[model samples]
Structure formats: C-alpha cells, structure tokens
Target: MPALFVTGTGTDIGKTYVSCALIRALKTRGAVVDAFKPVVSGFDPKDAAGSDPARLAAALGDPGGVFRIAPRRYLAPLSPNIAARLEGETLVLDDMVIDAMARAAEVRDGLLLVEGAGGVMSPLTDGETNLDMIATVGAPVLLVAGSYLGTISHVLTALVALRAANARVAAVVMSQSLDAPDLNQTAQALIPFLQGAPLFLAPRGESWDAGALADHLLTDLRAP
Candidate 1:
C-alpha cells in the first residue's frame, strides 16, 4: 500500500482539513482511501465527537467511530510526550510504527493518509518527534502551511529538517488562515523558496473544496 504523511509547519495549520479534502479528492478519482492520526492529544473519549480523529473518520464517511482511525488519544492539549506523562503513560516509537503498519495493511492497495500531530519537530514521545514517525513510516510527505505572517520561515525550517531526515516532500499546500495575508500573495512569496516542489493555494471560506485540491494533487502525483 502507498501512503502520504500529512504534516504541517505547526499546529492549527489545517492539516486535518487538507487531509480530509485530499481523501475526498482521491475517492472521487476512484481511489479507496483510509486516514490515520496515530497520536492525538486534547482528546476526551466522553466527547470524541469533536476530536480530530472523529473528524477524520467523518471525512472518510465513517463517522460512527474514531478509535480505528487514531489509536492513541491523550487528554491534555499539549505535546504528546508531556500529555502522555501527565497521564502516567509513555509513547513508544516502535509501537506507533507497528500500529501504523497494521493500519496501512488494512488499507491494502488503497491510499493510506497519515496525519501527523502538530509540527514536524513536535515531540511524540520522549525522544521521538513527528519527523521520526514520518521517517519510520517511510512515506512521502504532503507539507501543509498556513497563510500567516512568518509562515515562510516556519515552512522553510520544516522543509530543511525534513530534507535532513531524507523525507520526500511531494507537495506544499498553503491553507488560508483567518485574518491572515492574501493567500495568493503568500503562495507567490513562497514560490522562490519552494525549490522545485509544487505550491498550491487553498482559499479561505466558502470557496474551499477538498475534492478540487485533490484534483491538483492527483495531477501532480500522476505526473512523471
């Protein structure tokens, strides 16, 4: 099975949004898709309806459950390591890798989308970051960024870190942020810094559609 690891410059940067849209787009192209958010913090099992995992399940048209989508859930809205420690738990990188592999196997020949928690350097366990997870999974990346001030620096920094880890960035998506600069201008500004990766602008508000973004992504993925 093939997978795309969806990561971001930082949290709240629309990783889930872009991922959901990508799943929809892939499905529209007759691709069977499944999504995963391996480690999720700020989760309340009592109110799983509002969590990222639940939202991803909904996006996959499987709103009935979330545990299958995100196996690890922590209560605190902090980094995974701290959150796990707060609950007297520890996250093992190998266990996470095994879980991801198992889930990927379930997807079989379909596309398995893995949504990383927070930024690339966000700690997963004591010494493991999301970057480590990406490396362990050996999946190409779909880096997501926000159209906010100083976003270019964050995006570039993440790109450098990922490159250092030998991760392949398939594309970059600049998601529109509230009260932020113009998305088009933001994307244009990033063009020079993007090296050769394709740059996409995801507009804010009513005009946003995951299927449309997926079309662009599929086109790129199919390109030689």
Candidate 2:
C-alpha cells in the first residue's frame, strides 16, 4: 500500500481532521489503513486524555498493538523543540523518524497516513523542522489548507516549500471548519487558484465518512 504524509500551512489547520478522514476513507475502500502522528507538541492538562494521538486512536476504533498506531505524544502544545525543552526532553530527529518509519514498515501492505506536527517550517528541534521529517518518510504529502481569507498565499507558500524539499504534492484539501467569514467565495476561488492540482472542500460538522472521502483522496493520489 502507498504511504502518505498529511501536513498543513500551520497548526490547527485541520491536519488531524483530514488524517482521520483519510483513514476512515481507506477503510471504506476495503484497505487496511493505519495512521501515525509522531512528535505532537502541546498538551492540555484538562485534556490529559484528549491528546491528538489518543484522539487518532479513537478515530481508528482504538485498535490494539502499539507498533503501528501509537502517537508519539509530546506535552508542550508548542513546536516540537520548544515543547521538548519545556518537558525536559531532547528532540531526537533520527530516533523519532526511525521509530515512525519502523511502524510504517510493519504495515507495509497497508496505507500508512503519517501526520506531521505544525506547519511545514515549524521547528522540530534546535535546527530541524517538519520538512526534515517529511524527507525521512519520503512519502507524497497531502497539504491541508484551511479555508480562510488569504489562504491562497498560505497554500502557495506551503506549496513552494514542499516542492523545494522535493516532496511530491498529492493534492490539497481545503478544510472549511476554520471559521472563515466568506466561506463560499473562498472555496470557489481555491479550485482555479490551484490550477489543475485537484482540490476538495470539507464543511464543518461533517460526519467523518471514510467511503465518500476516499474517492477524493484517490483522485488526488491518482491511485487506481
């Protein structure tokens, strides 16, 4: 099965939401799809149990076995490096990437959706960023662009970074849950702005449907 890395223009840009949607969609297509969100920074004491990885686990029906499903939870809600520092931990890029890749290998025959922390340039360590992690995985990226004003610039900027890093652009999905004022016009313009790079719009409160969403993903991945 092909692997995909889901990232976004910035944090809270709906990367996790889209990741879950893809996992659900892959399941619908009769594929054994699994996800891994390595290096999540930011923790809410109140949400001691509401971690992104934990939430992802829940989204995937909380399957057993930690090899391929565990989310590498980091406590700071900040960038990985900052969070690591705050939590008295060091950001080990090699170790973290290796661990994530090992898990992805375990599910070699299944689609693996690896979600990145923060935006493309968010620092992961003293000198590293999510860009390095994406290179290590070497999977095509599916950038999640939140549907908001000025998204075009954000998307374009992110696209440039992804291309610079030699990461393949599977497609861009515009998440409509970001509370934008002019949702319609923004969504309408995204299509032509992307210029043939297929774009999909997701509305708020949308039921997480794997089957329906899979079609859109397949089109973006161009997988038969």
Candidate 3:
C-alpha cells in the first residue's frame, strides 16, 4: 500500500514533473516503482512520445509505456469528460480508472504513483472530479503547487478540498513557477496552514534534489 497520489492545484502545475522526479529518485535507490496515469487529454497518438504518460513511462524505464499505462487517451486538450465525449466515448470514472488503479495497486508493492489529471476540482467525468479519484485510491497525497502569485490561496484551497474529502496528505511541494510572489515567502506563508504536513520548495528548473525528497517521503511515511 505504499503509494502517493500526486495531484496539483491545477493542470500544468508540475504534478507530472514532480511525479517523474520522484520516480527517478526512487529508482536511484533501487526501489521498484510504477506510475499510472489513467486518463490523459491533449494527447496526439502521432506525438505520443511527448505525452505525459510517455514521459512517466520513460521515468519508469519503459519507452512505450503509454500504451499500457493510460487506458483513457483523448485527443482534445480539454477535460476528460469533454475529451472523451468528443471522441464518442464516455468516461465513467469508476468504470475507466478505479479498477485500473486497484489492479495497479495489487501488483505493484514498492511505490505506485497515481498521477491525477487536472486540478482537484477539474472534471474527470460527467460526475467526478480529480478529488474523487484521490478518494477512490485512498493513497496519501503529495500535493504539488506553484509559487506564482495567488498560489498561497490556491494551495490552501486545494488542501482544504482534500481535507474535505478526508484524504491523507503525505506531503506538499511548492514547485517554483517562472513568475512569482517570491518562492520562500510563499512557502513560509503556507507552512502554518498545512496542519503539520511537510512542505518542500523545488527549483523552477532542474537541480531539485528530488532524491532527497524521495528519501524524506520514504522515511517519513514509514515512520511509526
């Protein structure tokens, strides 16, 4: 049951970036890891290599992992509900993703990182949000947020939403954004709101000590 559901305040908030970093970091420690992105939109089969699942699959050491990892792939850059509908398909969240996550959890023991699509409130289907996905998995969350202006409110709001869903937060990463209201300042302001969850500030680009963060999570999560 060692898994982390990496979700963000919104799309493109570095959830995939943090997930891949943690995957590589865990791999470096000789840990068995698997990443699952149940649904992905804005995906073009022609450019599959550049998709999020493709990148995650690469991190999992599988080049063509997209085929096996994400079962629901949509063409449009919209929400999964719309994306699936546009393709003449319907995404019943439970039908499409729940059992897949359950199956992935059963087979993978080391670390299963379930990367959710879009923000917590983003539509996953006609009736579900990413929050429902997190609730369905019941995995500890590693909330990813950016340091841009208004992110303090965004992160806190996301955290509150998770709290409302009764999701256990494993950790939080304030992934640096290109624009900002100051990284450290934003992080400082967020500390008291986490209800004791640890927060890490990652560099906007590479050079983030993802391995260290990985180690911390492994150690901390396992703590008695």
Candidate 4:
C-alpha cells in the first residue's frame, strides 16, 4: 500500500483541505483511497457531523460519516497531548502508529492519507512532536504550507525538520491563507528552496487538481 502523511507548517494550515481534496480527486480517477485523521483535539462529540473526522469520512462516502478514521477525539482545542490530559486520557503514540500501519496494510494495493495534527513540530505529547509520528509511520510526506506572512520561513523550517529526520517529502502544497500573498508569488519564492519536491497550490473555492500531486507522490519523490 502507498501511504502519504499530510503534515503542515502549523495548525489550520489546510492539512484537511488537502486531504479531502485529494480523496475526491483520487476517487474520481478510480483509485481506492481512504484517509485517517488519527487524532482530533478540538472535537465536540455533540457535533460529530461537523467535525474534521466527519468531513474526512464524508469525503470517502462512508455511511454515518462521523469519526470513521479518527480514533482519538478530545474536547480542548489545544495540542493533542494537552487536550487528552485534560480529559483524563492519554494517546499512546505506539498504539496509534500500529493502528495507522494496520490501516495502511489493509489498503494493500490502494493509497492511504494519514493526516497529522498541527505543525510538523507541534507537540503530540509533551515529549514528542508530529515529526516524531511521521518518522515512526515512515510514509512519504505531503507537506502542506500556508500562504501567510512569514510562511516562507515556516515552510523551510518544516522541510528542515523532515529532512533532519531523513523523511522523504513527496510534495509540498502552498494552501492559501486568508488575506495572504498572491499564490504564484509565494510559490515562486518557494520553488527553488523546495529542493526538487514538487509544489502545488490549493486555492480558496477552487479545485486543487491532485493529479500531479498524486503522480509525484506515487512515484516516490524524494528529498535531497
């Protein structure tokens, strides 16, 4: 099974947007694709239908579309470790990793998108970051970036983190931010720094056309 981990420079930086879009695009092309959110920190079980996990499940046409692939849900809108602790629960990384691997294995000939929470370095636990999870999962990354102020720095820094971990970045997405720079301008500034990882843009209210994105990922685009 081919799996891609969707991680971003920071929270609310379009990780879900990219994953859902890809799910639809891949499905349209007749690829058996599924997504896993794994953990959701700002989840409200009362509004399960409106949660990120629900949205992802809905994209996959899963019936009852709520928390289909999101195993851990927390109430607070904080880092997952903190959110879990507040609810008197703890999210075990090893268990989550094993579950993710099993999900990927079950797909066999298909593709799986494992979406990470928060920025690449954001705390998963007080002792581990999202990068740590990505490392353990050992899947090629679909690094999502924002089109916000200082996003160039954030994107590069995230790349550096992934690079240090010897992770392969299949692609980088410059998802548009509110009141952000022109997509092309920001993307142009980043093209050279991408170190050969393909960069695509996800615009507001427009289809992101994940064809090329999928092509790069499935071909195993590697980081230098």
lDDT of 3: 0.85
Q: Residue by residue across 1-224, what tens digits does model 1's lDDT show?
A: 36788999999999988887777677778988899888899999899999888878887899975998888889999998899899999999999888888888888867789898999999998998999999989988999999999999999999999999999888898999999988888888889988898877777653466675676656655556
lDDT of 4 by residue, 1-224 (tens): 45788999999988888888888887887888888877889999888888888878877899475556988989899999999999998878888888889988988778989999998998887688889999999998888989998999999999999999999888899889999978899999989888888889888764667677766555563223
Clash-forming residue pairs, model 1: none
For candidate 4, what is the TM-score? 0.94
Candidate 2, superposed: residue stretches over 4 Å from native: 44-48, 63-71, 206-213, 216-224
Give candidate 1 regions above 4 Å deviation.
Answer: 219-224
Candidate 3 residue-wise lDDT, 6-93, digit = tens: 8999989899888888888989998888887778999999999999999899988899779787878999999999999999998887
Q: By how many angstroms RMSD does model 3 differ from the true structure?
A: 1.6
Listing every candidate in turn, what is its Cα RMSD in Å to the true structure after a full C-alpha superposition?
1.7, 2.6, 1.6, 2.1
Residue 69 CA displacement from its true place in model 1, Å: 0.5
Instruction: Name the best candidate (by lDDT).
Output: 1
What TM-scores do the predictions have?
A: 0.94, 0.88, 0.94, 0.94
| lDDT digits (tens) for residues 164-211 of candidate 2 | 889987778888755585666787776776656667666665384545
lDDT of each: 0.86, 0.74, 0.85, 0.85
Q: Please give the distance, in angstroms, between residue 75's alpha carbon in candidate 3 and its true position after superposition.
A: 0.6
In model 2, the worst 10-residue window by lDDT is 63-72
